[model samples]
Each structure stands twice: as C-alpha cells, then as structure tokens.
Target: MDHLLPLSRVAKLVGTSRHALQEMIRSGTLDTFDGMVELNELLRAFPDTKWEDDAEFRRITEIKERAFGKRVFERALPDKEVLAARLFELGNEYAATKALLMHYSQVLSWLDEKIDEIEEDQNKETRHALHVLRAFIVRHLAEIPPDAAKVQALIAQERILKIMSAHVTIKPSGHEFIVESNDTLLEAALRAGVSLDYGCSNGNCGDCRARLISGEVRKVRAHDYVLSQAEKDSGVILLCSCAAVNDVVIEANVAGASDIHQQQLVVKVKAVEVFNPQVAALHLLAPRSQRLRYLAGQSVRLSAHGASGRYAIASCPCEERHIEIQVLRNADDAFSQLLFSGLNANENIELEGPYGEFVLEDASTRPIIFVAFGVGFAPVKSLIQHAMSLDLAESIDLHWLADEAGYYQNNLCRAWADALDNFTYITHASTTEVETTLANIVNDYPDLHRFDVYAAGTAAQLQLAKRVFLKHGLPAQQWRAGATDA
Candidate 1:
C-alpha cells in the first residue's frame, strides 16, 4: 500500500502537535489524499522536520515523489493526446483495434435506441423521421469550412433577437417600463407614464440625463448635447437617444406629481380677502371636470385681462378643485395692481400649469428647515399643510421673514406652531436680519448634513442663504431653493 499516513501519525512522526498539522491542512499549506495526508505533501509542508533524517521516512518520501510525478504527467496530458501516443507506441498490439470497436459500439447503441423509440410511437409519421435525419445531416455538414459562415450568421441573428426583446427597470423607484428595440428610453418612459425630467424631445438639452446603474443600453440616434468625460464614465445616458439592449436598472429623477400634462383652464374667482393693506389672498375654483392635480409648493400662471403673473399656491394639495394664492401688492407694478385691485369675485381668469419642482420629498426622514421671505411663504404654507396631512413624523422648523409691512400672517404661523407638536415657527421682522438668523441657525445645528433645507425667497436672499448653508455642512442634494419669480 502507498504510505498515505493519517494526520495523527504524520504529526507524531514529524515531532509536531496534531493541532499544528491540522492547521496547515486547514490553511491550505498542506494537501491531503482522501482524509489522510500524502507523504510528499507532508514533506513539502515541513521540509526541515526531524522525520526527514530517519531512514524509513527518507525511503517513503522518495517513493511518494516518484508516484506524484507520474500522477501529474498522466493528468496534465489530454485524453486524445494520451490515446494517440499509446497507439503509436503499441501499433503491434490490438490497442487501436480495441478503440475502433468501442467507437462503433457507441454509434450502434445510439442508433438502436432511436430505432426503438420510432417503432414504439404508433402515431409517428414518415415525414418526422425524414426531418430528424435531415437535421442531423445539415448540422454536421454546416461544420464544413464552406458552410461554417452561414451557421455562425444564424447564431448571431438569434442572439440579436434576444437582446432586442429585453426590459428595463428603474432603480430606487422600482419603476419597470418596457423599451422597444427601436424606441428611445424617453419615448418608452413617456409611453409608460414614467415621468423623467426632459427638455426638447431632441437631444440638444441634457435635462434627460440619467445614470445607467446596471445592464446595457445603446445609442439609437445622434445627440448634440456634449457630455463630460466623467459623466460618460459614470454611466450617464441621454434618454432621448438611448435604447435599452438588455435588462437595465437606471437612476433617474422621476417626479410623480409633475407627470400629468399641463392644462389651460378658465377658473372662476371664488373669493378675495385682503389680509392687510399690503397683502391679499385670492381663491380660484377650477372647473369640476378639469380640476387641477398638483403637488404642494408648486406655482401657477394666472392671467386676467392680458395681465399675467406667476403665484405660488398657498392651499394644501388636498383641495384639488380650489387653490389659494397669496399676492404681495407691488405699488409700481400694474400686473400686481390688477391682481389685487382689478380682480373681482365670480370673474373668470386664465390659469395655466401647476409648474415648478418645489414639492416635498416624502422619501426623506430627516428634519426639515423652511425659510420663507415675504410672499414666498405662500408655497411654504402649502408644503407645511401637505406635510401635516401626510402625518410625517420629522421635526419641521419654519422661519418666516418679511418686511414689517408684509408680515401679516403671523397669526396663521402662530396657529400652526400651537397645533402641531413637531412644528416650530420663528418670524424675522426684517429681510436685513435674515443673514444673521441663518448664521445663528447654522451655528446651532453645526451638522446640517442630515437636514432637508428649503429656502423660498428673492433671488438675492436665496443666493446668500445657499452660500451660507453650503458653507455650514448642508449637502447640495439635501438643499433646495425656489426663487420667487421677479
């Protein structure tokens, strides 16, 4: 018998503990045969062990080395190469004859099985047998050099068909939409009602840029928009020009509320209340059949008698058929004067859109900070009401800033703070004090990294607040700003 000793015997012979020998095997430093250690592997693992000095161990090691080399050579050679070498060496013997007989026996056995199957099938047709025979001949014949290209072309066609039939999945949102082989991603998304932000159906703008999280997509048309090298390397694709080639997962900005088409409606003015001499609240009712479906914090364009202005919706989204807008009277502006003075109850006005992306992100569980300046509070009020309706558990802090004359909604703010346990309202009397207030707020929460900060104000105020918040550890993604239209 070959000297393949058990691990315990090997450990004893090598003057090492059984645990040490086992550790070597466990860590792959030593190899074993079955459950026993091979003599050559034991020697290789501990070349300087005292057992090597013994005469018996030296003889056993020499025998193991010779057998190991023989086994390696037998395994390294291919079967065909070994058989061919054996035939050349044993031509005078019956080795080649035996191999030829074995091949013929296998062929006969396969044919016999096929014949039995055919004979047993009572409903077998002659055409079926002919078809099988034709297929077998054609398959073998296609392997010939003259027909090989045609066979390969058929395989490539099948693979292409498979790739053209793949579906796409948008990640994080888990929206699955089908992209036909010839259609661009944007077309498919629009067709499936999966709204992705886009501008110009053509590829001139990069608004439809989305990251390819996994799988494959191919550009189906030319794009004029130049993407940065980093964007390209990060797997960003232009949705208007790319078609999915396989099961793909993409990261895209999909707004559910903005997915609906905008409508041009004639809404009736329900009522108008002058909250104060400088500020007024206007209520408009859309036609019941064409009620507006909009997100909170979105603005609408209202035109009355050729004078039009964009105003944020002050009412919560729960009031779908009716909307309330807060208007700050501009003494110099004729449009503001018409909205505040000329507009009357029961009068019809043109209302378009529910535009703007200032909606709340319900996915976030972080605390929220809302900064509203002057009539910017209109949208903030809507957002706060919507958040409250959703029963969101996050803490909400509202900082309302207005000039002394425009701060007419302090009572409303007070009512909200008193009603909601998680809500806090802080009013700043002057725009000049906004910077100091923001600075102090940031100082109080040194790590605003996890807070969703929203600022709605004049362009200058928003810009200043953006700089301060960004400098104070607010991530760009977590901070959103809506500039009140000039």
Candidate 2:
C-alpha cells in the first residue's frame, strides 16, 4: 500500500507553511490525491528535508513563533491512554502490512515454482525468456533504492509525530488543525484560530456538541451536558472535552461574526504597558471559565474606574484568555486617561462586545495589504497577528502611517518583518501629505485587483485610503475598512 499524508501533515513534515504547499499544488509542482500526498510524492517534493529530528524543522516554527507573539500550546507527549490507542492503531496497520507482504512472498514463491515447472516442459526460447524474467525480478529486489535511508528516517519521524499529535479536519467548513499533546479537539481548534461554535467552554452547554464522523476520541474533561443514548450511539461528542486519539473528521459549524453573540465579562487587568507619552496597551485577563470569545479586528467596550471606551483589540483571538487593547491618551477620553496612568495589575475591569465587521476575510487566500493610520494601528495590529496565526494570506504588507505618536510599536513591526519573508513593514513618519503617502503606497501594488486591502483609521482617513486603493485596480467590495474615531 502506498503511504499517504494530508496536506497539513505534509506541510509540517516539510517545514513549509500550508499556503506555500498550496501554491506548489496550484502550480502543479506538487500533486495530491483526494487531498493527500503519497509518501513517494512527499519525498519527491521535499528531497532535502532533514528527517532525523526537529532541529531543522524548528527553523520554520521559530520564525512563526517570533511573528506570532503568543504562547502556543505545548508540544509534548500525549496522555497515556491516547498514546496507547494510537500505538494500537499503528500496530494494527503494521500487522496488516506485514501480513500482506507475507502473502505476496508466498505468491512469488508459487510463481517461481510454476515457472520452473513450465520451463522444464517448454522449448529453449520459452525457457530462456522465463529465466530472464526471474533474473530481472531477483536483481531489482536485491538492490535497495539509493534514498532508502532517507525514506526510513522520514517514516520514523512521521510515526513519532503520529504518536504525539493527531490531525483534525472539520467538515462543511473545511478547516483543519492539529491536536497536539493533551489538548481536547475544541482547545486545539481554538488555539489554531479556528472559531468553531461553542458556549461555556467548560461544557455545561451543549453548544459544542458535534457528530464525530470517524476516528476515536476519548473524553478528557467531564461535562454536565449529557447526551442521550441515541446521540451517543450516533457518535455525538463534545468538542470541549473529547481528545482525538488519531486522525479524525467531524461535522461542525464555523461561526461568523453575527453568529457570535456579544459577550460580557469582568476581567482583571494583567498589565498597563505604556509606549511613550501618547499610547499604552491595556492587557486584561478574562475569568478562566468566562474567557472572552471575539474575533480579531473587532472593538470591545472596556470600562474601569467609572470611565469606559470602545477600542479595537490589538491582540489575536488565538492568544487565549488574554485580551489586549491599545489606548491613545486622549484628554477627552476618561478610559484612555485611566489606561495611561491609573490602571494597575489585578484591577477589575468590565469588558463587552467584539463589535464591528472590520475583520479579515479568513477564507481569502489573496495577498493582503493592511493600512493603519495613527492609532488606527490598534485594529490593524490585531488583524495582522490574527492573519499571522491563521496563515490566511499568501503575503502581508503593513503600511503604518503615523500621526504625532509615530509608530509606537515600531520594534514589534520590525521583528515581524525580520522573521517572516512574506511580511513587509513600511512606516510613514507623521506626514502632512497623507494622500500622497496613500497614493505612493497604492502605487506599489500595480496588481491591486488580485489583492485584499484592510485599512483602519478615522472616517476621513479610511475614506481617503479607500479611494486611493480603488482608484488603482482594487475591487470596490474587496476593500474593508474600520473607522477608529469620530
């Protein structure tokens, strides 16, 4: 049997982003069968992949880690039970393959005997042809392929990965993620920036229940929401509690913005990070059970010390339990003033929303251009980090047009640009000629029609940027903008 791997696993094995592999597939440089690549195909595509261990693989992962400044799930051994189940599955595969090989060997032996009997009774020409065929088989079987060691090392690494992590595929929506170590399906999915539907993540609500289409899942966490015998018999499992033992396919809903209801929570301030005199970041941690469920590029209403303001979240949703909002120190805004001076760690703050539609088109694979004007960088930053987490774009270009603040998070942007070849950071010093800057920026994208532009600014600034982008080749509907202020 030809060993096959999914595109996601092939990406991990090759130390390339899924988007890069996708590009290869689209260009016909790599071929896949039913969304899977044969083992030979994978070997052919990545002939230089170092399969001994993770040191070389860590190169790509390290860059992604730097680009996304969040503590991703730990890559460790799986739970003993899940590990045992995976081993059992692998053992079964091994046994079946061995059995087939033995059967093939017996068939070859019988064929040899039959050929000998025929050769003994045949003419000289027929017997000579038979002898030549036998010699050909013996010669090829005796010689090992040149890359046999490489193939063995690669398979060994893949088996270890299989024993440690399991890949998951969500149907209908077609989102994919890996279930690493002890993570439940829902935990892994959320960590991967896949916003599936769920409420009360600890599982009192049945909102997270989905039908398991295939593979084995063990319940890791207890839940109050009990399924009926019928549902249980039909393979219904709580995504929040069940851990996949091996590769799996499931039917689940991928939630959209309107699909997600506004959430309310009282969170504790984690820290107040002031970046110069003009800006500070308010980092808040939600209650473990009631963590905020919001998409990137959306605004949340935050209140502390009798002052409240709506600010775009400056952090990715993948950064679990932690919510970050950048505040511009405005004399007129009490919340901004509090963030700049009064907010301390562990202070209680009210949070509500995730309001606005200025979100990344998660499904779009087009190269993306993000334009942030002044404090407008708040939402754009969130969108950028989220895009990084999801690997949603083929390439990303960030145009941060500074006002008086002047690219306060310049170092962070530089770090991302340095770590990712596909990411470009262009900082515009506080420019009086904003339109000229916008025009110059748009001029760089001669093929704007094939791209998606996400711009965040005040209403006037967004209008100006949108006009410039559309005046170039950008499609009108492809332009998404968020108004940051009056």
Candidate 3:
C-alpha cells in the first residue's frame, strides 16, 4: 500500500516551506499524486534528510510558537476527549495492518510447503529451481531494507504531528490549513488568512455555521447559539465551538472584500512605535468580544480625543485582535500629529470603516510584484504578510521606492526576504526622475504579462506606474492599485 501525505504536511515532515515544495513541483523535481506526496517519493526527493534528527523541524516549530507569544514545549494540546478519539483511530489502523501482515505471512508459509511438494514430484533441474526460489524468498524476507529505520522515524514523526494537529479543507473555496494548538476551526482559518464569515467568535451568533463534508469534529466549547435538528442532522456545526478530531473537509462561506460589512468598535491604544521624526506606527488592541473584521490592504478610520483620520492598515488579519496602522507626520492631519506627539498607550480609540478594495487575488498562483512608494508600504506590508500566510503566490518581489523619510522598516522587509524562499526585496532611492525609475522597473520584467502587480502610492504616482507597466505588456486587469496620500 502506498502512503500519501498532503503538500502542507509533507512540507512540515521535510522541514521546508510549502512554497519551496510548490517550486519543486513546478520545476519537475518533485512529483505529487492528486496534490499529495507518496511516502517513498518523499524519501527519494530528499535523500540527505535525516529523518531521525528533527532539529530543523523543531527550530521551525519554535519560531511559530514564538510568533503566537508562546514558548517551546508549551504549545496547547488537543482536548482530552479529542485526544482519546485520535488515539483510538490510530489503534484501529495499527490493528488492521497487523492482521493483514499475519495473513500475508500465512500465505507465504503455504507457498513454501507447496513449493517443496512440487520439488519432490519434479526432475533434478526443476527441483533445483524450486529450491532456489524458496531460498530467495526467505533471504529477502529476513533481511531488513536499508531505509527501514528512516521509514520508521518518518512514520513516527507524522503520527505525532497528526495527534497534535488536524488538517482542514474548506470546500468550494478550496482553502486548506492545519488546526493546531487548541484553536477552533474558525480561529485556525483566521490565522491562516482565510477570511470565513463570523460574528462574536465565542459563538453567541451562528454566523460561523459550516457543514462537515467528511471526517469528525468534537465540540470543545459551549455556544449560546442553538442549531435546529434538521441542521444538526445535515452535519452543520459552529466553527467557533468545535475542533477537528481528525482531517476534515468543511463547507464554509469565505468572505470577500465586499462581503465584509463595515464594523465600528472602541479599541485601546497598545503602543506608538515612532520609526522616525516623520512616521510612526499606531498599534491598537480590540476588545475580546468585538474584533474588527477587515482584510489586508484595507483602511480604517480612527478617532481619539476628537481628532480623526483615515489610514491604511499595516497589520495582517492573521494577527488576531492586534491592529497596526502606520501614520505619516502631516500638518493637515490631526491624528498624525496626535500619534507622533501625544498618543498614549491604553487610551480609548474609536475605530470604524474598513474601507477599500485593495486586497490580494488570493486564488491566483501567479508571481506577484508589489510596488510601494514611501508610507504606502503600509498596505503592501499587510498584503505581503497575508500572502505569506496563504502560501499561494509562486514568487513575490517587493520594490519599495523610498521618500525623504527613507525605508523606516528596512530591517523588517529584509527579515521577510531572509525567511521566505520565494520572496525578494529591492529598494530604490528617492529620486526626482519618477518616470525614468518606473521605466527601468518595467524593463526588468520582459515577461510582464505572466505576473500580477500591486502598487500603492499617491494618485499621480499610481497612474504613472500603471501606464508604464501596461506599456510593458502587463495586462490591464492584472494591475491592482491602492491610493495613498503619504
């Protein structure tokens, strides 16, 4: 029997990123069957992988844990009841395999006896051939394969992963992610940058209702929202209240830009991170009961102390209730002045209107080119991080044209390029010759039509960039622009 693993799981098993595996598949270096990798094929592809030593795998796990403000060995485990169910399922598989192996062993013994009887009735040459065949079978069966230890290690690691996490697939939309560390299906979806519809994440409202198309789920939390018997009979359950018992396929509605209704809430200021005299980032924390619902590259209106302004959100939605918006120092903007000089932590701020359609084309697997002019990097940063979480882009190249403030978060961008195999970072010095710079950028991509480009800047800058990119063979539809003042 051939054992197959999903691409995401295989990426974890081999201590590599999903983007790297996708690249290998596109280049014909690795083979996948129905979007999954066979066990033996995984061994063949990564010959140098030390299956017994998982230090690299452990290192990646540590990074992810830290990202969630947790430490190693402290990752949340599945609920006890869910754990028991998974263990029982594994035991069933082991028992079935053992029974099949015993049956095969009995068949081999019978064949050995039959061969001996045939040998006794045959002539000298035929008897010698039967004896050789029997000896060959015994020798091969007794000797262990060279990769037996590796295979054992691989299977052992995979079992632990399955127990600690469960894979989830969203039907119709085809979004896939792993439910890890005691997170509900809805929580996992949001963290993976899959925007499924929901209200009151603790499940008072039934907006997160989804149908289980396959596998099993266990309710881990109580919900005030009630489901009808008919809905229950059809496998409908609240995503916020349940956890996947094993791998599951769920049919849920994914909210698009227009699908997300405008939300207003009172949030508290977390911090003011001033990058320079001209720019700073405002970090806001929403209440546990009411988090703002917005996609990456969208803008929000913030008002505090009767001073208000609209700014592009600089944080990815995967960050949960934490919201980051970079503010540029401007004489005309009251919020910018307050943020730079007087915005205090724990101050109450009113947030409203996640307005803009400048989001990612998440379903597209095409290469992406992101262009940011000055503080327009806010939304671009959001889009890039969202893309990273989704792991759908074939490649991402970021071109940041600095203003007088310069690349304030230059190190952050470099860290992204360092961490991701499919990411590239390029910086252009501030210049008066805008058209020349735009022309040079376009000239670098001869196959521009094969790429999707997202640019954010002032209206004039966007228009100039768009005209130049379109002239260089970029499809008009492939270009997405966000209007930014700073």
- Best candidate (score: TM-score): 2
> What TM-score would each prediction reach against the true structure?
0.48, 0.95, 0.92
TM-score of 1: 0.48
| Residue 321 displacement in candidate 3 (angstroms) | 0.8
TM-score of 3: 0.92
**Model 2 TM-score?**
0.95
List ranges where model 3 is wrong by over 4 Å: 23-29, 60-76, 113-126
Alpha-carbon runs more than 4 Å astray in model 2? 52-54
- The sequence of per-residue lDDT tens digits that candidate 3 reaches over residues 434-463 is 889989898999999999999998999999
The TM-score ranking, best first, is: 2, 3, 1
Candidate lDDT scores, in order, read 0.69, 0.87, 0.89
**For candidate 1, what is the lDDT?**
0.69
Tens digits of lDDT, candidate 2, 253-338? 98878888998889999998888899888888989787788788899998877999899999877777888889888999989877
CA displacement after TM-score superposition, residue 185 of candidate 3 (Å): 1.3
Candidate 2 Cα deviation (angstroms), residue 204? 1.5
Give one digit per residue, the lDDT tens place, for model 1 in 1-486: 344655534543564434455557778898888757765565567656543134554454344334222111122222332234333444533576688879977886687567666666545586477557757855764577653454344334323333333456677775555454356787666544455666554678787899999876777677789999999999999987787655567999776565746768899999887888788888898875456656778888888887888888887644546689888888765557987775778999889887888877765657899989888898888887655533332678998777644667777777667655567888776746677878887887776897998889888989989998999999999888777874
